[model samples]
Target: MSSQPEQTMETQQQKKKKWEMPDTYVILFSVLLLAVIATYIVPSGSFDREMMDGVERVIPGTYSGVEGNATGFMDIFLALQEGMVQSAGLIFLVLFAGGAFEIVERSGAIKGGILRAVSKTRGKEFWLIATVSVLFALGGAVGAVANSVIPFVAIGVIIARALKLDAIVAVAITFGATFAGFNVGFLNPYTVGIAQSIADIPLFSGMLLRVIAFVVIVSVTILYTWIYAKRVLRDPSKSLVGVLDESQASKEDLRAPFTARHKFILSFVGLSLLFFIFATIQFKWTINHMAAFFIIIGLVSGVIAGMNYNKVAITFLEGCQKLVYGALIIGVARAILIVMENAKILDTAVNALSVPLEGLSPVFAALGMFVANGLLNFLVPSGSGQAMIAMPILTPLADMVGITRQVAVQAYQFGDGFTNSIFPTSGPLMASLAVAGVPWIKWAKWMLPLLLIWVVIAVIMLTIGVLINWGPV
Candidate 1:
């Protein structure tokens, strides 16, 4: 009879497990449902918009109460279809660009090249950490934050094991550095470009500030990583992974010697990035242009790596398969806006958000935007999706609060980019952690401090943006 207590405890544990948090899709769709419900309770309103210089600008002080067109049951599902159709261009961009990169990865050039780099810096462990961190950071800067990034994360963990560092250190170099680069977002199209386009600023208008932030964030990230490495090196217990695994580098990693093909592919990627910047700035390349360029890159990269047309086609499809979820996320998130728009409550939500910020000074107002966006990201985690939902309101709110549109965009990027490192809801981050065999609890404990420090840096950067009236360049 005494065993009855243990049986009851087991039953209780299973019950608890049943109530655990839902997946990201459930959470997003729940939000969508709630928004549908909210349309009934929240008063409808809107602001006047006019086209100026081929861009739509929301006029401030134009918000007024209007009749609510509450969404019906049928309208809910219809919103999903409309959302996908509306965001089709962006969704295809994710697929084509993703597939192109997948082809590049399949060519074996990138992995072989990075492995060779790691081999050359065998004795200087800290330099390896710094260099690899920079490489990963550069990857994020170039819009490489997807499932395919797992190979790189795995590489970082292997390097960490060889150097007697912990998994957190591995993540610090990989995810941390990538986030630093991504948050600054100098040339990252996925986040920065969408944010800029939504804000109706010239594409990549605030390049100089982004360049400065990138250098500062990446350098700080490297120093922080090196500091942690020193701790782990001096005492293995300093590792959050319990204790460091004192193992040597895997010989398998270094088997592929760097070849001329790898060199050529790397050079092509570099020049392509440079040309992308020049083209966007000088020739005004849009998403279509970027998508076409990526397809060209994939095709050329495959040919150079000696892959046949059939192999290239297969590899490209495989890559597109990887990003299918992200593309759908963009659509589902657009559904949130679609339903709100259909119900005539999107502008109402915007008015509610803008009213309070209007009372604060520009700096505090900008800071408030940063915090609000950060908090909202916990629920709406996708970057492109968040842009769709938030920017319509923020663009005009920036005008109402005497803040620059560039500052608003900066706030959105800062708020959006940093959370991906710490949040469990992020698929790429969670997958990276799984590849490295690190637990979420440990990662959160170690990463919390760096995220806080990044927040401080972000606040300073945003304040500067406000002080200088950081307008589009």
Candidate 2:
């Protein structure tokens, strides 16, 4: 019996080591170091850029060798500073959003409301999942609700637990639904609008097909999540994150009543979200505007919750503190691109990759563009930024190969949006995962099967686009 105990202890230790999540900073820095090294091996090159219809676009055939500015060990530190400077706007937005949400969370309105909702939706849990996921998906399709969905992660967790599901299901319902809609991008201003503008196609001209894609993808996602939710609900032990679910679920205070205060707070949140969508679509609001709105919402929500000024301030700061790790990750991840840009090798990589598509058929060329954009997304995760760099090059290439510029935009859209969920560099996704308490490795493991299905769907859509000559060429 003594020997058996020792063996059990040793086995547990090995399992713990096997499942431990690697520090995100360490992983990002490792990628940064690898980028620094890549500068030496990859030939330095650049393309001439020019303003086209108020947007900067790369001029194809302007690619040429440039003098290398390889980053040394000391220069890496400078690159970090540069990266931080470049990403300051985004970093602050994330912080402010965190701060604002924290204040709202402290009010107990959200938690209380979720508990009440759980009680009400007891028998029709699948409908609850389907409804919420479809709504999120629609938001994503129209407005690109990636970061905006972060606040919902906590509520999703509550709902998932109330339904006897795991945290993974919560994340899937929130992030997964949003990303599926993002990939479809029927009218998303962030990816589709920007890519279409860059490609010089009428903005949202290909809406019919994208809308079709949206319905199919969102339906599939809801079905997939529902199946997993059913399994986990039936047997909690079957959850990949069973331990986290149990711990988190045990701590929830299900007795909190859904009072009139909760209703008002939730209404405020809902109205603010509606305003955000309108501002983004009509008035061209950026992340800065969104952050400011959140700040106002936070302060107002605090007052509505009967909190005094000092309490609100302290609670907001505490929320920001919780997200410090997630916010800093934006700057750190930016360092990889900074290092590559400072080295002048980003264009070289693009050029070399684009060279192989010259002789392929239109279908293959579109597929190649899809693959290339996906690879590039690993380095430059920003959708609009990638569009500015890629669409210009891809537009001319598409013209040369008989694929439509619209098809090229579709490829860029598919590549840029879908991978955000999987990419570590996506600050919003990482932040959501952090909020959900799901480790990146475990999330990836759970997501792989769905990801494969998504990829296949993307390929089929792109091929159809090619066959139909999706165009405004």
Candidate 3:
């Protein structure tokens, strides 16, 4: 009788129609097609620029239409190559970083570490969720790109399963938390650092308010993720990624004492991170710089983990190969912006968007600023890139609307950071989701409500900044 019922349940599961999600490329290309259509309808325009704060700034009132280089069908293919070239640095970082992490994985250090983490958190898994989320969140706040912490999502999955939670909880604690901190980045060099520089504020100035934003954002992530994890633990059917698989962290071998090789791998990773941080601040290291750093560290880690040169090379290539699909999307996503830039409508959109806030009060102006940047982030997903374009326009506009430049930067930060988590155009989000094996539609279903909550928090935070007349240090 038991076998018969089990067979029936298995039959039922097999008969159930599974959801087939569209590929990330299909979604991105579909959007790219829409962007091509947009070029025909939207008038092309340009602005005269003058250098301000050591970077080019668009003079607020100098917008004019020009003959558009209308984007055609052939242009779409051209945009792809151009986008790849334009985003080569970021794409290479993803490839190299993937290889670097693959080396870590092959060493069994991460697996060993996860085993220890799972063992330690056996009875206190809820706090484990909070602890891990906060750590990834801080990474975003402290100059890490939201996607930079994505390599850890695999670890998160292993830990979540050992605790009997689902993949949503796995990603929520890692990618989700990192993005939350990315959104509320108090000291984020890419978002906060760039915007502050353009806004003429001292570096790391206005940090106290950002600290509060960080707490609000990260706390909400912890609470929401824990609640969801508990709900799934109680009722497995409610999981977004239904039917959990047993994790490797549960195997008997994982419970053994860490080998000296694994221990050295861990120590080396910590030391590498410390040096990376120092190098970033002291040398103004870019993502490419960090990518090279990872390559070196990965090799050292591989040797320490007992892998010979050939094995390390093979493992590194395998890692990079795994990430190729995700990494390629980075370039594809960049094509949308390249298309707009070529058509010359990029400036037109910026100009048109700013027109509404010309005479609004600071409260509404600040609110509008946030919304505008959120909309614009779809077209230009890069943090520093968005800062480069939007900050220049919004800065002078903030002055005209009687809003503070610091508040403007806050709006830009929230707008650019929050949307990347949900936007289809965000390559890193999609790549991370692919790596997690959680589909975008499912991820969206889980993440959309949190994004709405973020918008509410953004409103409250921006309102406070406006009322306090938040100023530079």
- What TM-score fits each model? 0.93, 0.67, 0.68
Model 3, 42: alpha-carbon shift in Å?
3.0
Model 1 compared with the native: what TM-score? Answer: 0.93
TM-score of model 3 vs. true structure: 0.68
True-vs-predicted CA distance for residue 153, candidate 2, Å: 8.6
Stretches of candidate 3 exceeding 4 Å from the true structure: 1-22, 135-216, 225-260, 361-366, 369-453, 460-473
Query: Which window of 10 residues has the lowest lDDT sum in candidate 2?
Result: 243-252
Itemize residue pairs with steric clashes in candidate 3: none
lDDT of candidate model 3 versus the reference:
0.78
Better by lDDT, candidate 2 or 1: 1
**What C-alpha lDDT, on a 0 to 100 scale, does residue 373 get in candidate 2?**
88
* Candidate 1 lDDT by residue in tens digits, 45-67: 87898887776767888988878
List the pairs of residues colliding in candidate 1: none
Give lDDT for model 2. 0.75
If both were scored by TM-score, which would come out higher, candidate 1 or candidate 2? Answer: 1
Candidate maximizing lDDT: 1
The TM-score-based order of candidates, best leading, equals 1, 3, 2
Candidate 2: Cα lDDT at 87:
62
